[model samples]
Target chain A: MVTTAAQKPILLSGNEAVALGALAAGVRFYAGYPITPSTEIAEVLAVELPKIGGKFIQMEDEIASMGAVIGASLAGSKSLTATSGPGFSLMQEHIGYAAMAEVPCVIVDVMRGGPSTGLPTKTSQADIMQAKYGSHGDYPSFALMPNSVLECYTLTIKAFNFSEKYRVPVILLSDEVIGHMRERVVLPDPATLEIINRKAPTEPREWYRHYPDKTTGIAPMASFGEGYRYHVTGLTHEEHGFDATSQEVAKLLEKFKNKEIRNTKELTMCESFCMEDAEICIFAAGSVARSARQAVRILREKGVKAGLLRPQLVWPFPKMPVEEVYDQVRFILVPEMNVGQLRKEVERLRTNMRVKVKGLNVLNSVMITAEQVVERVLQIDFRSGSESEGGTSNG
Target chain B: MADATNQTAEPVDRHSWLRGNKKFPHMWCPGCGLGTLLNTVIRVFVAKGYDKNETVVISGIGCTGRIPVYVDCNTLHTAHGRALTFATGVKLAKPNLKVIVFMGDGDAVAIGGNHFIHAARRNIDITAVVVNNSTYGMTGGQHSPTTPLGMKAPTAVTGNIDPPFDICNLAVAAGATFVARSTIFHYQQTFRLLSEALEHKGFSVLEVVSHCHTSFGRINKLGSHLDMLKQQRDHAVVFTPELDVEKARAEGKDLVIGLLKKDATRPEYCDQYEKLVIQPSQAKQNRGGV
Candidate 1:
């Protein structure tokens, strides 16, 4: 994993890489409560941010930290907060508010095992479902998971960009493995980064609608006092940001749900390896993506034409791209840290295609190894007979 | 009373900047003092020429929480008891914006009590107008932190054994830069006190004794909104600069109407944050641009 010195490489932990990413992306305000596997984010920012003329506040609790970050963002500062599972649960209400209010901010959930403080230092991807449905009510949220320390830096920057561009809270979903693991990350100069600020109103203040037309999907966000005095609430609201309690408002609310993720299929990113002519395609993300990649490589060595579809953007659930791959493959094998959470989504979308979706779920503390994934891929009953049976049919 | 007649009658010639949907008059019960407090806030906003665009009115869930929906400012109707938390975000995101929070007794002193105190302790630049009706008015008048002792409410059928909190005293103790208490009946005093609170640079709390005709009124046999207003008027006492803590305490359970404390020396949370985060050149950089 070594690179030339000209690449501006630095050895850093996942938390450090995240901090560096935020700093490089022009995040000037950070408010977070310290929690295991995520405390280093706040600790590092507390010292590094201040030196770089950024404000860092260690709030009394996770709720206040979320509140502070939201406040800082509304005040026209690029702001962020970091927390783990339990803290993420506490932040759900506000997170929903961020979605409804269209506030641009990043939330880094350095996940540890938990329904309630299960393993504070240990890793778990149990929050995958929570990230999608944790907040009550119907709304769309963006979540990105990074497997390595380098991806931690890259994805955090992406999180900020997505948040600002979409004007919604984007979750940088990292786990204990990446948050604690140290590796080399080549830091990009600030000038090389693409930072997206929220779109501002082109119309007059009086005419501006906080939630504009569904075409752009993103409305112009006028900061307070910029003359576009509009309303923002967690309730079902009209385009003007006023509380709208009518059938029309309900329709608009549905649009709010769809426009963010629906037609914009390109925003969904995933990595595919050896899928050009494969019979079995394994789907996975985050740490499991690493194992799936390795499994695909091992299967290729064993003369099995298996491929991997590793989603970088875990939600808006890559359904279309996944279905496209499903059309070409005889079987889809999905592996996850949790027990078949993503498998459910895949099965649902692949229904019309009649693709056989099998899941390799590892609920225990151990990571899903490449060997296990390869074994599972080989066992899949694709039209091409099982790899162990030495069948030559590519169907 | 003196200022009330003059200020209301000779209304400031400001634009009717309030964009609140009139169809939804308010969620507060008839005769609720929150209406009076809201009117006073509107008046202050008008008088000060505060641009509706720059003013953000945030409210938590409760009867009082509905106040922001009726205002024409950039409003945020946040989750229950989390207005301070959300308002903290709005204020920090736009430090130049004038942010205010409206909360009920329960929203401020019960579920949101921690945030209330911490926001004050940090001296965040936001005005919190706590409409203290002494019970959880929205949830059918459950006993709250401010529900008077021996008050018969649904949650306290045998009468509330717990002592009530003097919210103004609590705010003063928690380091609020400005603290005041006023009742709806004292229109002039309430308006003036709220105006001062809004104008204050640091965290300010104006705990207004509001009437909840539906719940608190029914149980206490407070007759009606008129009767409750009169009761508050009768029970309130004016505090002077010469009044000591002992003297104020001796007035006991009565609404002490006056600015209890003012500490302009404390640095506002936003000012401190700006100093820490914004570089000299960066501060001068155009907002919403790279």
Candidate 2:
């Protein structure tokens, strides 16, 4: 959508909306490479960032882009980069570095079909597991899924907030459909949005620890010129950020997971539609959630009790919402663009909940449609006799 | 200056650039030239009166890459061959800060060659101190882009027939405003070149031809560390305008140990970005336009 000077609600693609979201969130530096689907974000940013007194750089490759974003973030700038699956795979090492060094940066992965660049311009939620555990070590990551153009704007802002508040790299897991689909979006005024800036070190230099092992698992960050001179590395280190190759140092990683990841409450975001007094729920994320919402509406019209639960925060996977809605629904149908990546997680986390977790997967970069979702939900034969028992994941 | 060859005395604390006693008994091997190079870097910092708060030291993976960790400045030890990329980010984001990258031959020219060339071409205001050890020392002395012809390495079990890269020539060709080559054997000259490179307001590269006695030396039969230093002193000739590259190589003096390029008039990247991005926006705002 071509944004005119008029300030009314304008049509915008998810990529354009995301770039606007970064501007609204006070991002001052963006480094990225051109990749399909996600490339629009970089293009929009390249034009818009300069207008807002921000910087944009097209790096040589995705790995360098990620590294540059992390570096800019460490220099006290809210920085970001956007890429697709192949580029996202190249960024995994630096993603780990950002996690280890506790840099506040945002990575927008407009996921496309992949294992090795499978689909250049098609949608897929195939990067779900890669986003969680692609890096070598165990470190916390915050990945958000936006199901609509408006959510792409709002959740990108939220991703920046999560990055600043947690001092960890946040991944905005978008898909090709949402990235390219044009929709009319009413953007909130930048002043009205809640922007969270990273906390600076209040303590003096002598007492400051870059990674303080506290209950909250968050420490104030100081940029390069802020006089908080410190060492940052990818190696497992102590609280002060020095290489400590000891068993004790490795044990400290538990606190990083518990405090920043598990203990945090507000970081997890999920939305449910038509879930009240429903017998079955379709679980989805990213672009597929849009289909699930329409599928639920279709099922509701037919007097078949079905609902949709969409997890906006895919990582630190909001299991509580799923658990809360677990007993209320008899079956949870997980539909994905991949071979049931999220379905496995749903099964793993829904251990004690006596719900039948099933998967409706469409590979080859094909999106799962609303009709297919409705058919899958309607195919629940009553005579099967508790086939939903034994929480084995079905693809 | 203090005896450049004296490896016994700890100079980091003496110069007040060392972090703390905890980082002492440094990670460099015995008779390693990284310590001397680090001492020269400290001298440059002190000599130039650079505030510690305004300096950011970045390095990539290798023995030379570990130099930033021991420094008391805001140091970042990045992934292999990506230090320049990170330093570019730092300089572009915070134009006031002095960004310096420490990289090894493999980190600078082999895997990271693309980034190095682009950084030079972009002419970002960052000083790159490339330690040309002619081999990938940290990864067991694999052949690097700077390895001389017929040199033996782990990856090249037979003699390496690949020609070596002249780092200064590459940087100059890629539009670096300041380029210099010096060796650890010529400590005073290396220190002088570092000082000049740090003062230059554009992309500058100070290539330090140092000896990697552990891997490169062991494989190539380049004698002890002292013998390598003697060889450097014997072969390295001061770079001059009239010197012919062919003649220098013919005399077993391929190392041109002096300033090879300096173009102060060329525009720097960060300044250009500010002029191109911020100035126009500010001008519009000043004229009462949104």
Candidate 3:
């Protein structure tokens, strides 16, 4: 939001900012089951949503919450749900359903440690891979990762905007450290914020099709009782109310799902920190990015020429900024709370094996500190080129 | 087969709400009770004059769940057992819509029991049509939560040791504003109960006791689909508030059919939401609360 000057800076946690951001982004309905590190989001919305005449429902479980959110969105409400790793797993089926059905909604996964209930109330950026590939089958996703409280508020609004505009489910990956960490954020004027809403069909009711015969396959969705009388199912079907479609329709769908490349240039919400004339770079996102930035500054002061490539929008991978960093840098240091989940992704972009890529993975239910990253970078003997960290994902 | 696209309000006939022969031959086995359940539900919808546009028929994954696919209205076929949650969202978001959820016994109780009970507990303005077939027919006949004790299915080749849940009793106990039960054989009674259930304001659950005659019957040697229909007729007795169900056990009748309970005074979920949440905020905004 553009303002002559920002309003008074109010101290709010990352979770609080997310809750406020959802409201500002025109999210009118919320369905969720409370889970650790993400419960505050539900708690905040439960109190605030009712004040604005918005709907909030605590569903029986994570599965029900996801289902309800989709249902509410179909009936023409901007809906959202928040949960942690365990809950996110439960939501995978419905997430796939929303994508296949082309329903617009937002899901916030406040990252907590887990393969299965691994660590609650602990900070870990472990769910980066899960957010992209947890749900079976491909669906176009626009995900945002907020490293700070301010980014939490702004990126959340952007997440909703992208979700509505593209008619896809957007994910917000906020880790426990950032979710619980309080920061002074200057809240923007509501009027100044740019809010995007899902497109409505202008065609007559008699000619209405839930999925139109158009390229990109994005159709203007009608609310359930608004008299358009459309059909939605998880089944693969054609434009009309006909049952299932053949192989021809499946080929037409190739352009529709996960095809968010050239169109979403504005969605590359990554930042380059002190990368000018740097030989070493760090790739990180979410809470880990904060430490990476600090480590970059520390390395630069010591004349190491280190920089950081932080992906605020983790998916679609922010390729250009990464390529710019990768082309110039001699070594890429990826430090994260998880055991190198994102490091595997960075390795894929390595066109040159000469560029030493390594991850300082810490999965001890604690935040990766700036000092630890600085130590990891300083310990690297550049001339000898003796690498200790594994380079390949399979390795 | 003629294209069923944009057929504007044809004369109220059996084909009006149905997709007609377009989606046929229908997927169900010839003797499956799903056909009876579907026809009766459509009949009730027609008699009650439910505008197709203003209605949403949702279903979970089952032969019964296929009801939404065949109905010419706003239909949503969602995940198995989660239809109630989805229906809840649709109804709560827009109170004007009549949201009906159709689920099989396994879908409604086994995988979806938590949602089922809670939806009733909240007394939300949605009609739950639970077709209790006592088996998971879609996946071959397997013993479901409603499968009677000592009944045989593929999963329970030996007699089923697990006790079955009474769908109507579960709904009533879970605070459903209207609860009723009927078999596919009792066409008129099923239609009447379904019609009343749809008319009720709060959560209304109508349990249609159906049969997976091909699977359950063949395994248990219970004869054909006709024999299963005869069994539903013989086993069922009309439920009355004054009738002693314990006394009926002596008569060898276990199934209780008809309206078990209807409570009109309890506040419907949607109306309460409108009054408590919507009205207060509107008043505040009118008073320049913003």
Candidate 4:
């Protein structure tokens, strides 16, 4: 069944596509817990990894799964783990540890409606803030939101690439709608796919700094048991990876933040539709972006000059592209499956702009429909038009 | 050697496995038993002729967790109670390398107990040394899960109503192939037990009954570190499966300090995984290469 002849376009859920993408990315180890919306990623990896000489273990719990992935990564394996809200919450401590220690790994959080397991079988974008600040401390993180099943595959591979290239944990944030939704994906030929391996140390073992404070801020990594007997700690450490508490050390450790922020242009990925000549634009991410796209098409047909701005790179939230369209648009409609998570970010970008940013939020894990978005857009337009006419008539 | 220019071939002295001057003036307080436990493992490493390059020492958060830092080996100081989980990956990924984990009582028995039991049940080939001081030493004298009943701590000022865990017995029950207990006062037995645990092929647990003079002792009025060591000496009794539990109870010597369980029948975890999953996949790939 795995023969090249059988490698035609096949229907796959977003979760299954993610597993295949991880395989294509040379993910040699996977440790995950069975949780709603994200369990299929684990189930698929468990069967697929063993066939491809990769190791997959359904850990005792989410916390252990995160721990195992970090360990595997440290031992020179492209490792991953997938979970949802509650499990992602349990993994926060280890996620912070991975960031501090600079272990490269990927985490897939298929977003579920939650303050605490709110909607397991349902979807929500409420975890957007949690993905950025859930782990305690000020460390850099990369989170990519996939709008389609195909994006799920490509973005998951991109997540691995970014994690290894930057030495940080990359979160592939999907929702139940995208995670469980099935679509046809044309499998890429393995030979044509570009695979990126981590940069190895060029210096002598005595001089190698696992956490080097250099120009690029990325230290060359040496896996365990290759004769580089070094110390790795979650504690704030100096360049050589020993515990330090001085103010200078704290200042030096700021490289983690600088590395990602400086490279934000490359890391920030987004897609804009018909933004060249638009009066009103819809801002959305994750699976809801698909609906926004459809709504934009309908609004354009109705001659309302509507467009859609979908953020593929959700974190370090792509401000430049959105700012580019700020003057071009009269209003921005932010639609989400939750009560205004990403909407707040969009609203933050609205500083002193006459462009009114309105949130079209849906709770209880119900997806925002295209018709609902069209209704909101038409209502806002009507209200804006009436206000303008009323002011002129009163004068 | 071409790719590993940073690693200089330094001489390893039999008397010292310490990393370098960077880790000098160790963090362990005066007369802390953690040093003795760490020294015993280093001696076994040298005695067993294990390559420093092939040994990875992992630890969790605690005073005991700091043991890996002072050693001149590949070390990973991970989050609290997650050393075994990390070691499981290290051992499975590179089965030839020796993975040893050092954790405290609270780390192993309380927060990390689930990982410990699962690692043991799977019988993964790794040596886990649990340093039992009966209190959270690093965070101050708080009562841990292994704190003895009626003992005083910061959290249990009056007395701890909960009974302490018999760590060796717990490990034995958890399916650890090799389980043993020894006190800091019993130096020879500590060395022997640690040596044996390292030599065991499957999941081996050696619980070292150590004292935290800073926290547990100061609160309980257990005198200086030496006096606590004497207390460990006085309370110790050799353990044997044939020993009558009632007699030991009546003798007021419930602390059994010796090898508790040793069974080598069960297949090791990583070995089975490699055989079942890894080898077949490799053979298929190789056969398809034709």
Residue pairs whose backbone atoms clash in candidate 4: A204-B5, A204-B6, A205-B6, A205-B7, A206-B6
**Best-to-worst DockQ order:** 2, 3, 4, 1
> Could you report the DockQ of all the candidates, in the order they appear?
0.46, 0.67, 0.61, 0.61
Name the fnat for model 2. 0.76
Tens-digit lDDT track of model 4 for A5-95: 3458888899988988898888989998899989999987776777776788878999999998998898899999999999999998888
C-alpha RMSD between model 1 and the true structure? 5.3
TM-score of chain B of each: 0.88, 0.93, 0.93, 0.92
Compose the digit string of candidate 3's lDDT tens values, residues A70-104: 99999999999999999999998898888777788
lDDT of 1: 0.78
Q: What is the lDDT of residue B246 in candidate 2?
A: 86
For A1-395, candidate 2 gives per-residue lDDT tens digits of 22323457888999999988888888999999999989989887877777767789998999889889988998899999999999999999899999887888999999898879788978889999998998987888789999999999999999999899878899999999999999987787666789999988899897888878764766788888888888888767887778776764765577568645655478668888888888898899989998899999899899988888899998898878888777688878888887778988888777445577877878767777899888778775352335543222222
Query: What fraction of the reference interface contacts is present in each model, in order?
Result: 0.67, 0.76, 0.72, 0.66
Q: What is the interface RMSD of candidate 2, in Å?
A: 1.4
Cα lDDT for residue A15, candidate 4: 91
State residue A61's C-alpha deviation in candidate 1, in Å: 2.1
The regions of model 4 sitting more than 4 angstroms off are A1-7, A385-395, B1-12, B280-290
* TM-scores for every predicted model: 0.89, 0.94, 0.93, 0.94
Candidate 1 accuracy as TM-score: 0.89
In candidate 2, what are the lDDT values of residues B1-290, reduced to their tens digit? 23433333355534577875668878887888899898878877776667888999999998998898788889999989999989988888889999999999989988899999999999999999999889888888899898888889988889898898889889999999999999999998887888888889999999998998988998899988999999899998898999997898899986788999999999999989889767886677567665
